[model samples]
Target: MSFQDEFNSGVLEVISPSPAYYPDTSRLRITLGDPPERVRWRSKQNLDFAYLMMYSQPKAVFYDQLDDILAKPHFITTMKIAAYDRIANKQSRFVLDFCQLGFIGKMFRCVELPWLVQLFFMFYSDKPVDRLLENEIHTKVSLLATDDAACRRAKDELWVHYKPSLFQHIGTQPSLKEKLKKSGNAEHPSDRFYNTTVEVLLKIVPLSEASENMTSDGYVIIGKFDSRCIAEGVVSQKLGAFSELRLTVHSVSDNRAILSEIFIWGQEAR
Candidate 1:
């Protein structure tokens, strides 16, 4: 079944905890107002904010362990959740980050505590906008402490990530004011995505005379004869090392072929 279908049928569960609320149905209490300029630097701290998308088996989390962490006064609860989940399940979780549109060439993968770090930055960081710089520092430090705790439990390798991101933010508008100011370049098209096909160009060049007449099986066929030394073709099948390319050079005066270069083009190749 599709992931969404499974999620709706209770075959899957996504535990996305918010920073604004506690397990006891009470809002987290924190100072409210603008943050001081000195404390603003702390906001730039690098935190793993890529754990929003994770898949796990049912009952992976031990409620007892989760409760133990939640009972503490930590601001980054998502990290704690991930830590205990690993402890109980004894297995790694796959996390994916949203791929920005128009950035297909720059796709990458890394292990990260996805939703855990962003929770503080997205929800709680702005709540105490007017708090003293010291309070802000304390809050930021508390977030880091929880992150450290989670990392200690969930090793760096425990988090596996998929490449050519499968997820992307739905809309073009940015949710945060800082991002909104740069919204013009914030949204673009993504070239790669999970389980999706992409178009690529394949070119082949003769490294030497030995490779010119190499057999390419039936994966490619000569499409055009540019010159006595140059040839172009279309890939009839997926090209690979096993697809032995054979170039039969033919001369105008003598029935001899001398291939200088070969160009191959197709919808996809490997």
Candidate 2:
């Protein structure tokens, strides 16, 4: 399997012995482990455009439109429902299917929007989730990102926009509840699949500290760090020494912040 190794906030640089291994992409491919064991993966793109193109011209248009919406720092309701469905379903045979798309989208995002996008679902069946759904989904994604407390304004909005359905599902899955309690939690494929998304914002998004005093107010406050180097070092070491990492960040009244929590997302006792 291929995987991207992030170190020191910048892209992990490895010298490939052969040019064949180094494709046109900026990423470097490396083989790790004794006896020549290795993993091949790329983080440049997360969707599959080729497969998407096979659908129809309308599908392609929706795909482009959805990309526009997702490129926004926040959700765009004008996004086609079908586009959301493909992503929610992991619509690719493998990664790198959307390599070019991710490359283009990153440029658009930097120039235009900054907040993550949200798609509204119809409550029950026919009723569309209110605008509050955006807030609620944001809070939930924030919680999964492991951010808590720390934002007074967002905190207030969270309570005003709380949803009962969240609690009902929480009981059915207590472990997920526990996972939400920590920060910098290395999200699983499932976590990445569901909930709102947190794309690595800006040049790089570091793994922040985990939250300690988490609340049911629908948010997790993982701490934030200054440099990507520090973030990658912490995250890399944690994964190497442990197995998984749970990342959390706490924000003080000021825009500045500190690391409050750090949990190994997929940690297993040694």
Candidate 3:
């Protein structure tokens, strides 16, 4: 069978039947539980933003917060589409936001993201990057647990990283400008990024000469994984800011695909 045939047949796992709300609503009075307390910030990044946001809130209230989001359609489907944006348009933030809301690899799982979506999210973020990258283009921080320059740069980038596409405001976003303009970063936060770094989960598959072997569907044997396994990855550079440059890794057999996702952060990063 063709790679496409195999891909459509199994490897990919769906998020189950679907994520939909009942179209019909009936009034039913019920006793309520204890009131929810305010959630305090655990860290500067609040990596557990989803969990903390939902943990303290009552179940009804927790889901209610996502009413605007859930009311539209099954988030799984929406995120799946968003995953494509990340791949097709290099919209890394969209994919990351999906993971943020869906909690891709978190322990205190809140929502479920389809397996393929998770892969695409990571693949795009894990663009191959040069360790010696400077400061101009999108740069990646090493996931090391030491106070070092590279790690510091990485953490700072993660802290300052922002994407305007995620917002729908009407005017200039002064708040974002302010966030981007801040200084005073630690000389070194740590050293050595993690294997689980969200944008660093790349699997490199080298091909001999794919043009000759590849099928019309653009499918190629990729280390037993599909080409659409994840989003395109960070690029190799001397030193740069975050980028939206999409790297096409499925052209020739010799060409390799670089994929990444937010599989690691917070405690896992340590």
Candidate 4:
């Protein structure tokens, strides 16, 4: 099976290549071994559209709006009650079916948004889950994203679209002002379009040291010489010595020197 990779902080995580992978929920979880000795954080944008779509991704929280209001009983017990009986009739699917169960299990595996979408349950739920007291809780939920919800922020009011589970998870509507007070570091897929990658710095140092370091990191340096004639002589002397290595030039006072090093291979995990 194919795999996908994500760079988070100093570590790299690889997961299932499923297209459904998102920051909140994923199908598989695996780390790409241990942290590399050194890593350069490259600003790459592969999922900018998805990241841009989110207004304020709320932290996964435990919020039960119907804590004392609705009794926590069996999955269908609340459905049979007077408050949910009407909802049951409208929704014939009593218990979760196999497909629903699979997706629900996936959600459970992620452990973020549960079965309830208290306010905007429609976004996350195919059919209302009265069993979770979310059907009626819709009336109490103030957070909303209309059918024609726009991605743009609303003036004088913060706006969110598509993710109603945020309201149910946060227990209350989020304050955009509060969210903006903090900074965001996650890279979006569209970020590459506007990303300005400039030459941060330039260093003129000894080539042997730099080449040695690269070699230690699994880079195959074929030759390190001061001039083309000397590089040819060194290679001619050891015909097949650096055949498997990638040829490189490191000149110093007309002298040739070659250093070998080890390095880890591959980026991220699959």
Candidate 5:
């Protein structure tokens, strides 16, 4: 979809789902059936600020605080857009045509980008006329610049990017040119992407089996035992944070039996 359409729909869904309510006593109690087109245009300009933020490298601390920034009453004004345009024109397009296919191999390490831009290339292209211009411009940089310095300069002049990318490319297959038959290794994954998996390891032992001495409490038992002789089993279950795992132990006969040990190990989930 066009950026304008996407922006309008998103605003309708998120910012103004219905006519906003105001206090009866307030001076601004008047309500309109629909916001004027100019108001929508101003909102779109504010959204352009979001794109500008994503393109430019802001302080690492503010990477995850974009929502808070956008919540401000006057975050992006028309004056700021005009000021930025005066300093750095966003209208210019940098097109670099590759005449030699062999030159592509040597250009691999020429440009290093944030994970988000890398992800755009993995699943999108400029072949289709309807594709977003931003994607086309971003992917075009690698072809336009021959060295790291040139690429870095282009990025500084174009848009902002955040460090430790918020999203990762996890697909094991390519989506581009899917109509053509292709084979061989197709995995393309981002190395710098943040790891979101939360793992937890739990160990349970009978009250009698647990060490009475505080010094020896560090030791844990992790070994195998015959189920016939000793009732032992491992259950691999997914659980959420602060969830409880209850274990019930019973003896084959009426006689009392002690549950020796239970061990579970995995990274703590976040």
Candidate 6:
């Protein structure tokens, strides 16, 4: 069978079921989390701003926080016609907002994601990225553990070593007029690009508070396009931010035949 045929047959897992509220649609409520030590700062050359980079260890992986999952990777996609509901039903909204408080992952239990939507994640990122997920990108998902303290330590060291310049102490620098003008125009192209991507994602997704829970907290965002494609576009649009960008579809159950979950991750440099 063709890849498409395989996808339609039993290859892809569905995370939601059809219903009138979503009418001819399916959804999976996605939840995300980070470890307390996974958050850190990075610098972009042009903007004179520090971009926050969230990290993870091999055993200490980030999760979508969905409940009763079979613990395996699932294949999925976001066709052009896919759309997400703006008004999550009252019941669904409650599920999305409350998934984190339950210590679902910390205590090794699953919590209900909105159940009206699907979830996805990033399983791996090669140091030197060659390409990114776009239309029809394929991937699998899996579970990770936090038992390897050594892996976590290695990740911490690597993060500190290659983190982008934070323009540390910029607040102490004088904001001279001419200097400001030169500095504004002198901003790095890469930094500008990076800022743009974050801004776009913020506008499109339900981003967490800028100053809130740097680690141990995350956001669930709904956009009109296939998440995998959007993620790939962002990665390609800001290719220099990292050496690689990839994703996995953990659970998908949309009836619209157009949508899928797209999870993102920040990786260590090779």
**Which candidate's lDDT is highest?**
1
Estimate candidate 5's RMSD in Å: 21.2
Clash count of each predicted structure: 25, 53, 39, 10, 14, 15
Using all chains and alpha carbons, the TM-scores for the candidates as numbered come to 0.21, 0.18, 0.18, 0.16, 0.22, 0.14
lDDT of 1: 0.31
lDDT of 1 by residue, 88-157 (tens): 8775543211222221111112233233334444543343221222232344345545676664344323
Candidate 1 Cα errors over 4 Å, as ranges: 1-123, 126-156, 180-270
lDDT of 4 by residue, 1-270 (tens): 423333544233333334443333222122233122111110001122113212112432211112111122352332224224434556322122111110121111112233332222233222213222323223223345343233111211221111111111111232222211111112221211111111111123234433433344444333332312222112222222222334443322332222221122222311
lDDT (Cα, tens digit) per residue for candidate 5, span 39-137? 333233333333433444342212221221112233334324433454475543222211111111011111222443333333222122112324444
lDDT of 3 by residue, 122-226 (tens): 321222111111221123344352556666555543322222223221223332232211111222222112111122211332234344333344433222222
Error of 6 at 104 (Å): 20
lDDT against true structure, model 3: 0.27
Candidate 5 wrong stretches, greater than 4 Å: 1-135, 138-146, 162-198, 201-270
Total residue pair clashes for candidate 6: 15
Worst 10 residues of 1 by lDDT: 63-72
Best by TM-score: 5
Candidate 5 has a TM-score of 0.22
The residue ranges of model 3 lying beyond 4 angstroms of the native Cα positions read 1-36, 39-82, 85-95, 98-149, 152-162, 165-270
- Cα lDDT for residue 262, candidate 5: 31
What's the distance in Å from true for residue 146, model 4?
12
On a 0 to 1 TM-score scale, where does candidate 1 land against the true structure? 0.21
Q: Scored by CA lDDT, what does every candidate get? A: 0.31, 0.27, 0.27, 0.24, 0.30, 0.21
